[model samples]
Target: MAMKAIDPQYTADTKYALEVRNVDIYYSAFRAVKNCSFGMERNKITALIGPSGCGKSTVLRSLNRMNDLIAGARTEGEVLYRGQNLYDPDIDAVQVRRSIGMVFQKANPFPKSIYDNIAYGPRVNGWKGSKAEMDELVERALRGAVLWDEVKDDLKKSGLAISGGQQQRLCIARALAVEPEVILMDEPCSALDPISTLKIEELMFELRQRYSIVIVTHNMQQAARASDNTVFFLMDKEDRAGQIVEYGPTEQIFQSPKDERTEQYISGRFG
Candidate 1:
């Protein structure tokens, strides 16, 4: 399906799930990404693609303030969600992260039982429900990630005992358990086999119906196939900071990119 054109400017009436305006990320003195701007539409999947050292992951991490965990990592400029600046002094980073959950490049499920893994987030966030209600919530989250049928009977098994793909899905389920409005995936399928990667792509489609998704991926084909919109980033040779080269509907970005650099990169001529 064709995606609507995104206006870089945000207004009170705009329908963007998240609007990143002039965002610059730095690790201490080195600016890693500069002046990045884009809007991720509600219920659509947006992919961030670039070669190595282009700050794709850095941009993704900033969406939920995950960068805050790294020493000396800081972000300047505004990331607006629901018309509020997420970087405001009054904003709570923990709540921001809860509302915009993340899945890492590698699946790092806690070393706990599958049930506990899915239940952990809600519990920490003050779940006041009976056992049956918690069970229902867990089931719903697992079903949302397309992993319910595969592991329904093994809820007591160690999360680490599952296959790599199942572990990834379990991690996704854990994120869903928190009922986030947006999901950020940083190469969630990078370590999976082809079939597992396809499963992850399919799960992404299902999840997009309810939550906005932003993914950072190096796989061009995956970006072309799975995303409604695409943002391409490249390093600025002058200062070695990453910046957006192009962003638009996936079809146009892949078929007729306006920038020659975009075309060259997409066609594998150069990074």
Candidate 2:
């Protein structure tokens, strides 16, 4: 079957890449995230930071309908992309995922060769390119992730044979292979070493020039260091649902939070 195109309302004039409105997410009867509203600017990196189990990841997954994969998981309200609601009935979840790619907390490269790892997404999406074109595409994605130089000499090697950092980069290159407009990362550096984390942070800056990025991170320092904007979430004690405490430019969020809860969280006083 032919894939559905995004609604024609997608004009170049839209200011934000994504506008999340009054979004609430639930797993079965439990509300995980409540009333999230924020605009992710074009070609910028936005960080979602909060303590664990506060629904930061839940909200991140909803942006691309990843939550739908979980049984009994659902989302209410809208996630707008180019003026069209992604949750609309006619919207294609597969296409939504293609347009908005994801990189999880741990690097998970397919057990295939390095070249095949990068080529997999495009191939799955029905790439009709010739062998030479596929090679070029693989090279482009690997270079984009800054992994080309290290792995170029061994494209046939198994992706798992690489170092953990290299495996993460390979996973990133795999995501880049499909040329997504928005990239959602969930604690992408949590398992990496400091050097690997630094490399990923640098890659995020480079990628921000071409793609909109939203990352869910537990590392406050990483959020402050790498993101253009920050959204802080906290669990509502009574309801046990996560709620946004503040959303603003990274500098402002780190230096001077507006909400006392945000201030307390950032200052290490409480979760």
Deviating ranges (above 4 Å) for candidate 2: 1-4
Candidate 1: where are CA atoms >4 Å away? 1-12
**Top TM-score prediction, candidate number:** 2
Compute the lDDT of residue 163 as modeled in candidate 1. 95
TM-score of each: 0.95, 0.97
Q: What is the C-alpha lDDT profile of model 1 across 158-185, one tens digit per residue?
A: 9999999999999999999999989999
| Per-model RMSD to reference | 5.9, 1.6
List the global CA lDDT of all models. Answer: 0.94, 0.93
Residue-pair clashes per prediction, in order, are 0, 0
Candidate 2 on 1-271: residue-level lDDT in tens?
5554786456767678998999999999999999999999999999999988899999999999999899999899999997778998778899899889999999999999999999999999999989999999999999999999999999999999999999998998999999999999999999999999999999999999999999999898999999999999999999999999899999999998889888888889876
Displacement of the residue 13 alpha carbon in candidate 2, Å: 3.2
